[model samples]
Target: MDFCIVDWGAISSIAAALIASFTAIYIYFQWRNQKGAEVIANEAKQNIQDILEIIKIVSLIRQKSSALERSRNFIDFNRLYESVVRSSLYIDDCVEIKDFKKAIDEFFNCCLKFKEFESLYRDYAQDSKFIAHVDSEINLIQIRGFNIVNTLIPYSIYQKKFKFRKK
Candidate 1:
């Protein structure tokens, strides 16, 4: 009778190699997923920054409009209107920003109407009704800006909290 001997050492080495390959593959996939997540987070942060810049432009328009109201000068009014129209192009694509844009449109339309009446009576154009309408539109813009900023706060907090973990 012939007896065959099993090579236990060879079997153990093969098993070890298989386990190491699997671990390496798993780690590679996990790293790829983490990189994807980081890219998404960075994009979100950039969007927030863009929204903020739009808000600043809107605020500038509001300030200029208010000044034009007080000064009752056509030059300032034209400048303010031009600024609002120009800044609208920079507004980010978001729900709150859309609302702000709507308010700006309404305000611009109101200004046009006011201009029509200004030729008849300058004082009447600056009446309480006109002031109130402008005030409401400005308030709406402010509210929308605040809401957009509020939405970004959580992302900022998350980034700050998790930034160290990536390192």
Candidate 2:
């Protein structure tokens, strides 16, 4: 009877140890999963915010371009071209969504320079050649911007396949 009791005690101790170990492992994994999820959520939020900001800047560029056409001075045209080229370089260097955001931010800075120039230049009417030059530059900027957007769309789709969202 004493031997049976000792055996029962041994079994109970082993079972309790197993349960505790399993619980610890489970808790560790659960915490890891939660941390992963939070990281993804934060990334998503930042990415979405970046995209929205880029969209806003693009919209502003379009609006400003329209008004800029009336300005005979081509001062903003050179700046716009520089910005577009810089943005193209940025896009070429990008490998991920966050890189994309950085590229877009660079592009936004360029657009803002163009915007600033436009605000200053649009106050006057000067020469037909200047107006024409500005118009041409705007066209080029539009084409390049569209290309960047097109290139990014596929990447964003591919990114969706990854568990960018932590579950």
Candidate 3:
């Protein structure tokens, strides 16, 4: 009787192949997961940039409001109104910022009423009641805008003089 010997070499080769295949699959999945993370990080960065841009627009509107308060005129009010309309584009995706937009709309409406008042009375634009109303509305818009911006950005950034404080 002749005894046949099993080929250990062939068995070892097959085991090695299986291990290599599993390693390749594991590496491929890891790469895919890494790519997905990179995409999400990029999107978050873009969102932050958009929020920053919107904050800048709000700041511009606030500055214009101050200028309008200093020199009340149809031209400055018209410019500020146009700026408020332009800012709507930035606040489209931001639901929290929508309140600020509503405030801007209210401020714009007040400007229109002031314009009408100026046209009707000419001298009543500087009346205490009208001036007070406009100032209050502007102040409200500024406070709301500052709060919204502070919520979006980090405290470090705000602490570095990027914050808007009521004077």
Clashing pairs in 3: none
Q: Model 3 over residues 1-167: C-alpha lDDT tens digits? A: 99999999999999999999999999998876555445433433443444344344433433453444434444454554455454433333322332445554554454455445334334544477865665565555455444544443442232222212223
- Tell me how far the alpha carbon of residue 99 in candidate 3 is from the true structure, in angstroms, after superposition: 20
When 1 and 3 are scored with TM-score, the better candidate is: 1
For model 2, the local distance difference test gives: 0.49
lDDT of candidate 2 over 1-167, digit per residue (tens): 35533678889999999999999999998887566545444443444444344444444444454654424323334444444445444433432344545555555555455445455455542656655554554554455455456545544444442233222
71-153 per-residue lDDT for model 1 (tens digits): 45444545555554544433323112334455555555655653443343345434777656555655654565456446445
Give residue 158's error in model 1 in angstroms.
4.4
Q: Which regions of candidate 3 fall more than 4 Å away from where they truly are?
A: 1-4, 65-167
Candidate topping TM-score: 1
Where model 1 places Cα greater than 4 Å from the true spot, the runs are 1-5, 65-149, 156-167
Pairs in clash, predicted candidate 2: none
| lDDT, model 3 | 0.47
Best by lDDT: 1
Q: What TM-score number comes out for model 2?
A: 0.41
In model 2, state the lDDT of residue 150: 53
lDDT of 1 at 32: 73
